[model samples]
Structures are given as C-alpha cells and as structure tokens.
Target: MTDVPRAVDRLDDLVSLDTGEIDRTIFSDQEIFDLEMKNIFGRAWLFLCHDTQIPKRGDFFEAPMGSDNVLVVRQRDGSIRAFLNTCSHRGNAVCRAEEGNVRNFMCTYHGWTFGLDGELVGVPGKSIFYKDKLDLSKHPLRKVAQLDTYRGFVFATFDETAPPLEDYLGATGRLGLDMIAERGDMEAVPGVQKFTVHTNWKFTVDNVFDYYHPQITHMSAFSVGLIPAPPDDFVEGGAKSDTGANLEVPFLPTDLHNFVVVGEYGHAISGPDQESLEVTAGTEPFAWRHKPEVEARLGRHGGRVAGHPHIFPSTWVTTNAQLSLRVPRSPDVTEIWWFSFRDRNSSADEQAASLDSQIHFFGPAGMLEQEDGENWAQSTLQTKGLKSREIPQLLKMGLGTSEVVKEDGLAFMDAPINEHAQLWTYHAWREWLRNPSWEELRERTIPRDRY
Candidate 1:
C-alpha cells in the first residue's frame, strides 16, 4: 500500500468499518458528499457512451460526471472529444438534447455555437456583437482534461494531473472491461435506459458486490426464475435465525469462488470466477475472448471469474452483455443509466431474447433494481437523522478468517459470499476523500497479497 498523508491520518476510523455495516451518515452528509464529488468523481476516468453511440462525425451523447455533465462528440477526424456541457460564455447549457447528430451546438439562450471538437464555431453576429475582438478559440468549450477508450468504451476525466487511462485502470480494471469486450463483436444496444433513484450513489456501487442481498432484496426475481433460487431446505450460515447459525448456513456452493482484484488509485474488480461453467449451467452463452485458449490463458486461477466487475466510481460490467453507469446527482439522489449489448454473431431472435432478459432484470421495469432501490432510498433517509450519523457501520463477514490468495493482479478469497469487496471500496473511498497526490494515491492502493 502507498503511504498517503491525506488518507493515512484517518486510517483507523476508515479501516475499522465492517463490511455490510455502515454509518448512515455517509449517505447524507453534505460535506462528505461534496468531498466525494471532488476526490472520487473529479479524478476518476468515468465511463461515457460507447464509441458506437457516436460513430459518425457530429454525433454526440450527453453523459454525467458527478453533478456536472459532458458532451461526447465524434470529431470529423474520426476521433472523439468531450467537453463540459456548460457554455463558456455564461454558464448556460450549450446543448439540451440527450443525443443526436448536429453540425454544431447552438445554445438556446444566446445562440453560441460550438463545433464537434468543442471549438467555438459560430456566434449569431460575431463581428457585430463583439466588434470582432472576441477570440473564439479562447472561448471554445472547456475540454475535458483527458479522454480515452478501451475496447470501444469511451471515458473522460476532469483532473489534468490524473494518470493516463491505462495506468489508472490497472489489470483489475482492465479485466472488468475486457469481460464485455471479450464477447463477440459487441456494440451498445442503441437506447440507454435512464432512471432516477432516491438514494446516495454509493449504495448502487456497493450493491453490485453484494451477493448476500439477492435472496432478500430480489426475492421477486428469484420467485419468477429470473435468477436461480435455493431450495426450501437451503440456508447460508444455518437454518437458525441467529447470526452464528446464519454464518454456518453455507450460502454459496462449495465450489463457487470469488475473484477480487484491488488495484492502483483505488480501482477494483469483484466477481465470481469467469471461467467456471457452473454459473452458466453449461449454457456457455457468451463467446468469451480467446475461448479457443481461454483455459490456457487464464490457467487454473482465472478460469472461473464469472461474476460482476465494477470500475471504480461509477461503472459496472456484468457477466451478461450489459454495462451500467451510476451517476450521482446530489447527496440523496442518483441517476442510473443502462447500456445493454448483444453478441453480433447471434441471430436477430437471439439478440432480442437476450435484450428482453436484460430489460426484465435491470432496467426501469426490472425486477431486481426495484427491490434494491427501496432499501437504498430508505437507508439514505436514515442517514439524515443526527443520532444515526454517529453509529458505526459493520463489514465483519468472512473477516479475520479467510486467507486472500493474490495472483496475476487479482486478489482471491475462497470465503462464501461476503462483504470483502464492499469493505475494500469504502476503504478506497476514504483514501480518495483525503485528496492525496496522484503518486501517493497510487502508492497507497497498489495490489497486495491480502486486503
């Protein structure tokens, strides 16, 4: 781990946190939330729409970064660039459409226009309005500090000093995106499903790692066969209601395993091993990259990672052809966007079927997200209470017991479904809130044998 002054002083309080347990205050504190906007969202390489969404010049899409929004455009030179959507002239939004093809953006208020590359291209009466003295170049849209793509997923950052996209992503983060990229000839499914949840953004992020919640939160999905449900006699810790009994219930199948890849700059990936066929029940639906030699490539270690993978701050890559972005709006509100994709090799019917399942599982009408959102919303409300803010959250499941196996940039733990990944994220979050130098941030969060 890197030595970081900004975060080190708060280490004890931060690490003391138990997985699945948290002080309600974190969800509603204005100061903490504001710091998160700067330390986490400001510096992270947040996912924008896929390159396919803006394949032609003049095509653009609007994406959120914390409370701010950016316009990602396809340039005439066959490249992509992004800039803040706010106008350089008077802070008015320069573009209002969610996505469309346009030669230039004309601000509704003052008619200021900007080119695809965010260059100021036209003003209604440039010479007459400003005596030809105003420099359009100087007032061009404020370009994002960095923009990059991996396997077609575009991303941008606001911090000029942030590390290059690849370095910041690390192997863990790369693997997360690669999971979707490895699927055959993938592309975004066209429309992005947007919905708002009355909860803190972090709830959506941490929930991705929560295998423990599905049975309870998404019982509807389980009952309807959207997800496989355990038999009546099955139990995790035990059949008893006590924590010790529940701890002994044996929730996960003995063979099911999890791969947790903790990386530099607070990026991490947590999921079931992909190579394992048990997850697919022998369906083998996805055409994973290097399938001809994936077993050889991943070896015995990586052959089984088949669970959800999350990029720090706001991106989630699921085993199915889907990606989701959790955009923070305010301390108690979050906007989630879903990008569903399909294997280009599949027939039209298969693609449609796949999309149907995706919609039923995660979108606005999805069974799973609704249940999860309720708890999140309620949790956020609890945080607003003064007394609730002082109580500590807990993440003790599978703690102090499981030995983490570290290999090939991934941190492995054989423990049954637990809160290790969620706990690790909060620890990383605290590090970011301290706002250390990039070098220190990286140093403090490098991969380790155990975390």
Candidate 2:
C-alpha cells in the first residue's frame, strides 16, 4: 500500500485547546483540506438521505461523501445500501441524476450497469469486449464500509473499523437527532434544497452551536417577526417609539445563559436552556417539547433540547426539524444541502406552514442563510492572506469560569452568553485533525470539567 502523507504532526500548532486559539490556515490551506477529506470526511458517519426519501424499491439518491458521490438505494429486499456512484470500469458516474427511481444504474459512459445492491449485472457487448476479460462481479460499484439508520435518518461511512453508528453518536448526538424524529410521523419535505457557499465547512459546523450570532447577524429575523417578539418589552421604557413598529426591542441581556453539551467525536448541543429560549424567542416553536407525552418520548436531555445540536464533521439539526449538511468542496468552498421535515399526520395547513418556514429559513433563497453566507465567505477569504492569518482567532469567552454539569447521561454547561460551545468545537476539531486512534480521539474530546 502506498503510504498516506504524515498529516497530523502540524495539528497541534493549528489549534490550541489550552488557550482557545485556532490558526486561520486550517480554513484556507490546501494541505489541511486534503487531510480533512482523508481523515474526518473519509471516516465519519455522514448523513445520507433519510429512509423516507427512497422508501420504494429501486429508489435511489445520489449522496455526497467527501470528494466522491454515492448512490443510496432502497433494494427490493427493503434494505438500504450505499455504493460509490462511479462505475468500476473507467470510474465514470453510473447515475447522472441527483435522485430518482431506477431499476438499475447504467453508466452512460461504457454502459456498465449496477443493481440496487451494487452488483455488476450488465455490460454492453460483454462477449465482444476484450474477450470478456472483466469478471462482471468484480466491476461492481464501490460500497460504503458501513451504512445504517437511526430513527429513519440514514448515514454511511467509509471506514470499516470505525465504531458502530449508535456508539459513535452517543446520547448527545442522538439527542440532537431525536428532537427531529419525535416531531410526529415525520418525513423529509419533498426535494432537498442545495447551493454552494464560499466558506470552509467548519465555519458552518461551528455556527450550529452559535447562539451569539443571531442577535447581530439575524437582526432582520427579529425585526420582521420571523423570530417572534418576546412577551416583555425592555425597549427604553416598555413602550413603542415615535413611528410604529417595535424597533428598539431589548436584546437578550448580555447575561442570558446558554446551555451546552459537548460529546465525544466532536459532536455538541448548545444554545439557551429551555427557559431562557422561551423567554427570548416565542414559545410556539417549542411548546410541543414540554407536553408530558412529548417530554417522555424525548427522554432526558432530548426533552430538554432548546439548543442547536451538531453532529461532528458536519451535520446540524435545528429545533425547527430541518437538517443541513455542510459538505466540504475545497479549502474555500462548501456546498450546503438542506432537508426539511414535517409531520405526516399534521393537518394540511400545519404541514404547509412547516414547509413555508423551511423554505424561508436556510436554503438558497432563505434570508437568514444569505446573510450568514456572506460572513462565512469573507471569513474564509481573510484566512488566505499571510498577515491576516497571523492574527489568532480567539474563542476564549467563558473559557474557565463556567461549571459543567451532568444530566440525562450528558455532560454539559449552562452559563451566561459566551463562547463555550464554539471553543469546545474547535478544541474537538483540533483533536480530530490529529488523526488519533478512535479511542484516543474519544478520550481527547470527552467534555472537560469546566468550560
């Protein structure tokens, strides 16, 4: 086997857990991006299409795995499997469409075809083609090392030795996913929304746990009522000013506490605790979780999730029942795919409202993400400058002062507005970039005694 380059040695300098400092080069360096594709993206259990997406026989969705794409198909046996979209013969894509129902994937190139289970079953002019030297079975698409589902959400990984999906996710990660699953008999909204954003995938991942940005970056949301106004008014005198609209609403007091859960393998859940969020944002979005039945269904930390939860590498689950995949394309480019979910049993109006919220929240035309993309893009651009990179990126707020607590089988901290979650994620990011053994990686990322 030709050896892979030594990629972990420089990681120590790139991120400093002790000081909560991260070198900007990791976002702009070609070498670091290549290594990430090999280590992080190559081994992690990445989210594929949800089971509801390809429920019928012969259904398939072309999903991205790092630089390559895979065909995620539902076999006649009702089992789901994923395989490289490339034809083994000449490495040409076997399926051209993003998703659809097909009896088999036929490579438009040389006409090699694969079954739903990824078996090589057909080849044009087989007998006349080089005396049929190619063993038909040997030319099958490359299958993922592991593919599994949790509550209908499917995921696949390229590392055979990696831990089982459940253990890898741990309670913290699953809790993030559970919030979406327990929202009734849910199914992904038809048609995924995809668009390219000029930014490092890490920026998107880290932002999932960011409660600090909404007040500033999403000001329009508050002003336009996308995020409902709080019950109490703190605007200079609890009174609307001169012209009309409540323009001077008070921001979450600088002291608003945020809760967090940092798990092994770099996953995290962070945002305001249940009460704080209720106090700031409207209660309608979260009232369901407080129902006795819903709380029991959620179980422990899952029930208490008023925060944004992020699965390591790049899968983000928001309280709104939407999932976003931040796919890394290059050091300075990332493609985002959005999957929205709604309850099947909900009234038509309810589902329609969910879809409308989903469409206007974070996809290509979403007002929120459009603004966020600009910041991420500019952030990535600055990293490419020599002098710009030297200015250390800081994530030191609430670093050592916050106390972590254990509850519902999770280790987490709840504290006033601060950078604990972002810093924790970067600390975990550094550990992943080290390319340590799974045991060591898990050991390194276990939540600290304090933030």
Q: In candidate 2, which residue pairs get closer than 3 Å at backbone N, Cα or C atoms, i.e. clash?
A: 399-451
**Against the true structure, what is every candidate's RMSD?**
4.4, 4.4
lDDT, candidate 1, 1-451, per-residue tens? 9864433354445444434455556778677778888888888889988998898989999999887899999899999999999988889999889999999888888889888878889887889978999988899999989999988999899999888898888777887787777666888898999999999998898888877676567667766788875644444643666444455334444344566656666566665555443443445454454476655655455555677778888898877789999888889999899999877788999899989989988879888888888999988887787787677766776675666676676666765666777877777777788788988887766645544
Worst 10 residues of 1 by lDDT: 245-254
Misplaced by over 4 Å in model 2 are 1-7, 229-252
For all predicted structures, in order, the TM-scores are 0.90, 0.93
lDDT of 2 by residue, 1-451 (tens): 9775444766777777678888887888888888888888888899998999998999899999989899899999999999998888898888889989999888899888888889999988887866878688777788999999999999999999899999999988888899898778999888999999999998887778776677668878878988765445422223566786565644545656677888888888888777777776767888668788888877765666688899987899987899999999998899999999999999999998888888898899888899899889999899988799998888877778888887777888877767777887888877777778989988998887877
Query: Pairing residues by index, what is the TM-score of model 1?
Result: 0.90
What residue runs in model 1 are displaced by over 4 Å at the alpha carbon? 1-21, 231-233, 236-256, 274-280, 286-290, 293-300
The lDDT values for all models are 0.77, 0.84
Global lDDT for candidate 2? 0.84
Per-residue error for 387 in candidate 1, Å, reads: 2.5
By lDDT, who's the top model here? 2
